[model samples]
Target: MTIRVLIADDQDIVRTGLTMLLNAQPGIEVVGAATDGRHAVRLARQLRPDVCLFDIRMPLMDGIEATRRLAGPDVADPLPIVVITTFDLDEYVHGALKAGARGFLLKDAGPELLSQAIRSAAEGDALIAPSVTVRLLAAFADSQKEPPTQPVEPLTAREEQVLIPVAHGRTNSEISAELHISPSTVKTHVAGLMRKLGARNRVELAMWAHETGRA
Candidate 1:
């Protein structure tokens, strides 16, 4: 199935480059492009694309607020969004995740990784750039004034194994290979982790893993 995508970036060249790059990939289509956050939101609501790729900084509104409007906790039906940014600042990462982005990537993430991220988000999985995943999440956890919330129930050993790779941004297939388990089993353990940790998504699960020093 072709994954329709919306691109939102203020830079004309960047937006154009992304559209061209995604369109060149198999089974991916750039359905819409937006120059700013509000335009992106409007296009997203109207197009209902499979994924929305947003830049962190934009005029009129920022990607974080745009993500919140479409995918925030209060939204009736949240859309999947992946935030791509030039800056690797912790605040941008934290804000985008808090606002409901399904994935996060640095602008220089190559075409293959970018495509993978889009596919992952479309498949209800989340990816964070591996280069920044460990450092940024650890920093966020340390900077939190309040202690990380404890899981409702302790994680089983299998679940603990799954959490480490997941916190490192491995996909289900990757984790399954690493742990010598089936993808379905990996998914089951992921779901259990989410339930016990009260995580809204894989991103939150990853954050919890860092917060509690499990990863």
Candidate 2:
């Protein structure tokens, strides 16, 4: 299936570059482009694309708020969003994730990683930039004075096994192969983990893993 994408970036060159790069990939199409966050949100709601690619520093709203409006916890039907930014500032990373962005990447993450992030988001998975994943999560974890919330029930041994790789940003297929389980089973465990941990998405689950020192 072709993955339809909506891109929001203030810079003309960056938007054109990304649109071209993604359009070149198999099974991916850049369906729309917006110059700012408000327009992005409007187009996204209208287009209902498979995924949204947003830059952090757009005018008239910014990507973080745009993401929150479309994919935040309050939204009954949250759309998949991937935030790409030139800055790797901890605050930006934190804000995007907290705003319900499924994936986060540095603008320089290159074409392959960028495509992978969009695909992952469309598949209900997530990918963070490898360079910033550990540092970003660690900083967020450290900033929290309270202990990580315990799961409503104890995790199974398999669930524990699955959590580590997920926190490390492994895809479901990767985790499935590593744990000698089927992809369906990996997804099942991931779902259970989310429910038990009160996590809204994989990103939150990853953060919980870091907070609890499981990652």
Candidate 3:
């Protein structure tokens, strides 16, 4: 199936660049583009694109507010959103997640990563780049005593081990190497972990890990 996406960014150049790059990928289409946060939300709600790529700053409203309105836990039925921005600040990253972002990406994360993030979000996964995640999360951790409140649940020892490295932005291949397991095994463990934790994607898993002081 073709993955439909909506791009929300204020800059014309950024919009054009993202649309062009995403359009070039197979099985992906830029269904709409919004010049500001409000329009992004309107277009997203109306179109119900598979994924909405949001920029943090925009006119009329900010991406964080728009994301919350569309995808927050209170939204009844939330759509998946992936935040895109040039800033890599911890506040922006954490705020985006709180507002119901499925993933966060640097504006310059490049075309390959951009494409990957869209597909991942559409598949109920998140594609956070390793480097950006580490810094963003560490800063978030330092500023908090506990992560945002989530339901209490027990996790296996093996899952706990897998969860920390994921918060540190380790990929399946890296986790496999660290735990001396195959990548497929890591994927299985990840899926199991998400199910147990009620997480939509890796980003939530990592966020919970950090929130729980495990990351």
Question: In TM-score terms, which candidate is top?
Answer: 2
lDDT, residue 214, model 3: 86
Question: lDDT of model 3 at residue 153?
Answer: 62
- Top lDDT hit: 2
Q: lDDT tens digits, residues 48-150, model 1?
A: 9999999989999999999999999899999999999999888898899899998999989999999999988887778888877778666766678888888
Question: What TM-score does model 2 achieve against the real structure?
Answer: 0.91
Q: Clashing pairs in model 3?
A: 147-211
How does each model score on lDDT? 0.91, 0.91, 0.84
Candidate 2 residue-wise lDDT, 1-215, digit = tens: 99999999999999999999999999999999999999999999999999999999989999999999999989999999999999988899889989999889998899989999998888788888887787867677668898789899999999999999999889887898999999889989999999999987676788898778787
Error of 1 at 64 (Å): 1.1
lDDT of 3: 0.84
lDDT of 1 at 3: 99
